[model samples]
Target: MTGRLWGLGVGPGDPELVTLKAYRILRDADVVAWFAATGRESNARRAVAVHLRPGQEELPLIYPVTTETLPAEVSYEGLLAKFYDEAAASIGALLDDGRDVAVLCEGDPLFYGSYMYLHNRLAAYYDHEVVPGVPSMLAGAAVLGTPLVSLNEMLTVLSGVLPADELYRRLVSADAVVIMKLGRNLAKVRDCVERAGLLARAWYVERATMEAQRVLPLADADAARAPYFSLVVIPSATAPGR
Candidate 1:
């Protein structure tokens, strides 16, 4: 018998950011799974403490961050494929054994999310469910006091991991843009922001929804910008003297 699977996005870094539906799913989950850096912390797992139960099974998928330090030439696709294969194997084992599972996602499951990789791997073979949660962009936009997009505005969400030339083109045409994966890629992304002439309107948000959440104008931010748990949003309108 195929067991049930839940890919539940828990939002950015705050427990309060989790949706009521996500809360229900978490409380009822028979098994909890989250991505964890090989030997490091799991913020995703920590955020759900209010609803997490003792003795629930925990499946910690090895997140690539803070793990692989190889040269930049490595084919990330190949590396990620290996990780996905391994993750699928683990989830498959549990499902085959008739254990229902909840895969905790940090943000919207399908939005530049890690859960998608696992979901694509596991969902085809089992009964799966995706529980949407508050997105970081929403939480960050509220914290920064900015509406990400207005009527008919073309909004684009990009991965900072893209090549600058490619990213630049996309930014130029977009009325509002959200750049994710801004850790080590911050410099590259900042350059694109400058090239696109959108720095004046860009804002950076990090660890959104948490008490330690941070927001800053891209103009004042430095190379010391926080990486990983961060994002930059650029609105099309000029604030003042453009």
Candidate 2:
């Protein structure tokens, strides 16, 4: 019999935020797999490092290129597609050997997490389970001590990489917003927020729930220090109390 595949959401930076169900599966899985940048440690692995049982095999899926500024001759999308395909094959090998493989995701696996790509390729042929964990946006809101949406208010989650005009339109339409993937797009996103007249209401959070966490008004956030893990959250304009 082929071993089962598990996608474990390790939670946003904090090990304790991992759910009991996810923890149990993680400890029992025969092999642990994680995605990482070319030369960086895996954040998901770091979050759960202390809890991992000794002797479990580890598999690293390192990205060949993480930035979009690749050579004009190279196709970024094509390279990534091939990378994911190769990653799926490696994980499939472990599964076929009757060894249960657990892939660690930094946040909820389906929510902008790297595990989704592997899941899409392997699930059709294997028995798989996805264990959801705390997502970063909720962690950011918790750290800010601000309510996201009040009664009848719609909350929109956007990527900071969006075009300026598109970002502005969304910011203006949403009653509350969470813009993620800040990295190099911080300046553009900040500008869009200001143009939408929501700068004062927005708060920037970096690495929420982690040791290096920072929270400040979006307007005051330094663009140079904003990493991909950073985000800007705009709470509801109207107050709704218990």
- The models' CA-based lDDT, in order, is 0.81, 0.90
lDDT per residue for candidate 1 within 1-242, as digits (tens), equals 86789999898878888889998888887789898777866777877866788787788887574535778888677788898889888888888888888899887888777889888888788999998877887777777775667777777989888999999999988888888888777888888999988898898888888777778887666875465778988865732222
Which residue pairs in candidate 2 have backbone atoms (N, alpha carbon, C) closer than 3 angstroms, thus clashing?
none
User: For residue 8, what is the lDDT in candidate 2?
Assistant: 95
Residue pairs with clashing backbones, model 1: 183-227, 183-228
Name the weakest run of 10 consecutive residues (lDDT summed) in model 1. 233-242
Candidate 1 regions exceeding 4 Å error are 64-67, 71-76, 238-242
Off by over 4 Å in 2: 239-242
- Compared with the true structure, the alpha-carbon lDDT of candidate 2 equals 0.90
lDDT of 2 by residue, 129-227 (tens): 999989999999888886889778898999998999999999898899999898888989999999999988889999899888989999898657477
RMSD of 2: 1.7
Output the TM-score of candidate 1.
0.90
